[model samples]
Target: MKAILFEAPGSDPIFTDVELAKPQSSEVEVTITAAGVCHSDLHVVSGDWDIATPVVLGHEGSGIVSALGPGVTDLSIGDHVVLSWVPSCGTCRYCLAGRPAQCSLVASVVAPLGVLHDGTSRLSKDGRTLHHYLGVSSFAERVVVPVSGAIRVRMDAPLDVLALVGCAVATGVGAVTKTANVQPGSTVAVIGCGGVGLSCVQGARLAGVSRIIAVDIMPEKLELALRLGATDAIDSSSTDAVAALTEMVPEGLDYVFDAIGKISTTEQAIAALGLGGSAVIVGLPPTGQHARFDPLALAEADQRILGSNYGSVVPQRDIPWLVDLYLSGDLDLDSLVSARRPLSEAPAALVDLAAGHALRHLLVPSI
Candidate 1:
């Protein structure tokens, strides 16, 4: 199979042919249909997070099941599915508690080891083992994922759009509906209108928020946010985002989401919150970076700061709902797809993503 291998940090990935091992007993092999070039992938490629090198780099994707290993009875060949990077062990403490997003098995083992739950690589090239990125390396023509990570969806759902639901959509919408639980008629502001931020705008609109404020340094993104669902937009590059947000909502916003994964935007989200309002940190900033907040103000105002991982999503529960919303013409998945290119163009797509030149660039491996 052809895959993009991240040979080292702060370097471009090498596109080359690799060997894929067959699925294990509980795994499923999928022929990649479409994969979204996500910011998280860019972060890894840029060395923001110290991930293991010689790994396949991708997570958000949709595909058709090509084969199933022994014991994989729920899915079969030809089943269309969306891949979840964070696959859960159902018996783990977190999974049992309905917080599968924080499954300890994945956090303690699979992530650090960069392998399957069984602690082995399923990909290799020239006799060298390649690490898996978040257990769903979809930047290739095919991938072997744990059955638990594959959520079956309707075939009618566009694979390119479904690709976004695997990460960006799930994270953004889940943050609003599950983590912050923004109430109807409330005021909300989302900083950084990237893929995740735009989805947050759409989520807020779906939740019936009276005012949805979109903040970003990019005017094009702000305009796109308005088209998605934002009631107002702010050019944070030219205007002070915090001041503009404060002036827009003197009492503070009911909910604020920082989707850029930066300390500055996190602080902005915190400062813009109303009394008793919650600030949801949706972005994954580089490791070791921290945001300072006013302890006294938080105590007096009863404000809350919450960290949302993967939008606190349960893939099986949320992906279908999002699909329904998309089918109903409520969720705008089509607009999120800024461009589509073949697998060979993935390297350049990653560059454009890092340069902030594209939104949800979907790599159609079959193209």
Candidate 2:
């Protein structure tokens, strides 16, 4: 099958042929329908996050199940599913506590090795074993993932559109509703109007936030944020984002989300918080990157700096509900999709994404 391979950091990802092995026990093989291009994959390509290579590089996707492995009785062939990178073990402490995103196997093994739960690649190229990205590796025509990673959503929902719910939507919406738990009538600010950031805006709106402030350097993105749910927009290109946000919310924001994942935006999110407010770090900065903040201020004001991974989502519990929201029109997921391209155009799509050319691009294999 064809897949996009990132052989090394700081190099262009290649669209190439790869051999996919059959699914193992407690795993399932999904024929790729649509995969969402996300910044996390870019992080790997850009060398921001180091990983084993000759790796398939995509995590956010949706597809139809074609095969199921042993012990995977919960799902069956032909189920339309959304992929979750963090496929937690149900019996683990984290999963039992309703925190599957921080699953022990994912944290210590699957992620670092770029393989499935058993720590082996299901893909290979030219006699060399290829690594999986976040265990999903949905960039390919098909992927073999752990049963827990393939989340079954309603078959009626469009698989292409549902792809975003895998990552961007899950992370963004999860940060507000799950991680921060922003109360209705609270004020919120989200930096960066990309897929994740825009999702944050939508999540804030769904939480019934009184003021949803969206900040970004792009005018088009800011406009989109307003249309999504943001009550106010700040073009960081022409103005200071922090100063503008301060002017709009004199008392400071109840929750400030740094969806850009840069140290600067992370600091801005922290600085823009009100007393007892929380700064949700929803974006993933490059590995080894660090931010500086005033510890004294946080202590005095009773503020918090929360790191939200995968929006702290339990895919089994949350993905279905998100799909229902989309199907009911309560969630404007249709607006989030900017364009769709064939799987072969993934390299160019990544270039466009890095240039901030679109909101969310779907690489449809059948297209």
Candidate 3:
């Protein structure tokens, strides 16, 4: 099968033929229909985040179950599924508390090694082992993932668009509905207007927030935000985002989400909050990146800064709900998929994503 491999940071992604190992215990083999080109993968390619070398580079995708390993009973062949980067052990403390996103096994072992739960990869090229990305490695035509990582969704939902629900949609929308739990009639601002940021806009709308302020440097994204649900838009390229937000809401916003995950956006989200509002950090910054804020201000204002990882979502529970939302015409997922290209064109898709030329690009294995 064909797959894209990232050998190291600052190097071009290689689209090469690779051999896939069969599914092992509690694992399933999925024939990937569509893979989302996301910033998280770009971070690894750009050296913003470090990971194991010689790995497949996609984490968000949708596919059909082609084979199931021994001991797997919840899924079957031909089932449609959405892949999750964070696959949890249901017996873990975090999973028992309804916080599967913080699964201890994935954090301690799977992530650091870029392997599956068994601590081994299923991809190789010319007998040279290749690591998996976030345990999904959906960049390939097929992937072997643990059952916990593949959430079965409705067959009616288009597998291509459903791919976004795995990452950008799940993270952005989940941050609003799950992490911050923003109440209706609240004022909100989402900084950055990429795939995740735009999804944040939609999430706020779905939550029935009164004032939705969409912030971004790109004019196209700001326009898209308005169409999705943003009541107002701010272009940070020519105008100061924080100042514009302040002018729009003099008393500060009820909630502010920094979906860009930059130091500047984090500080801005904190500064733009109301007396008791929360600043939800939804985007993932490079490892070791830090943001500085005033402790006195937070204490005086009774504000909060929350770190939302993967929107604090339980994949099995949330991914299907998102699919239902899309199928029912309430969520606008089609708008998020700006383009679709063949898996071999993943390198160019990464370039367009990094340049902010697209919202969400899908890499279809068949295309």
Scored against the true structure, residue 59 in model 3 reaches a CA lDDT of 96
Report, for every candidate in turn, its global Cα lDDT versus the true structure.
Answer: 0.92, 0.92, 0.93
Across residues 196-305, which tens digit of lDDT does each residue of candidate 1 receive? 99999999999999999999988899899999999999998899998999888999999999999899999999999899999999999998998999999999999999
lDDT: worst 10-residue window of model 3? 108-117
| TM-score of decoy 2 | 0.98
TM-scores of the candidates are 0.99, 0.98, 0.99
Q: Give me the runs in candidate 1 sitting further than 4 Å from their true place.
A: none
- Judged by lDDT against the true structure, how good is candidate 3? 0.93
Residues 1-367, candidate 3: write the lDDT tens digits: 9999998887899899989999999999999999999999889988998799889889999999999999999999999999999988778899899899999989987787988998888988898989999889999999999999999999988989999999999999999999999999999999998999988999999999999999999999999999999999998999888899999999999999999989999999999998998999988888998899999999999999999999888899999999999988889999998899999999999999999888899999898
RMSD of each: 0.8, 0.9, 0.8
Residue 79 displacement in candidate 3 (angstroms): 0.3
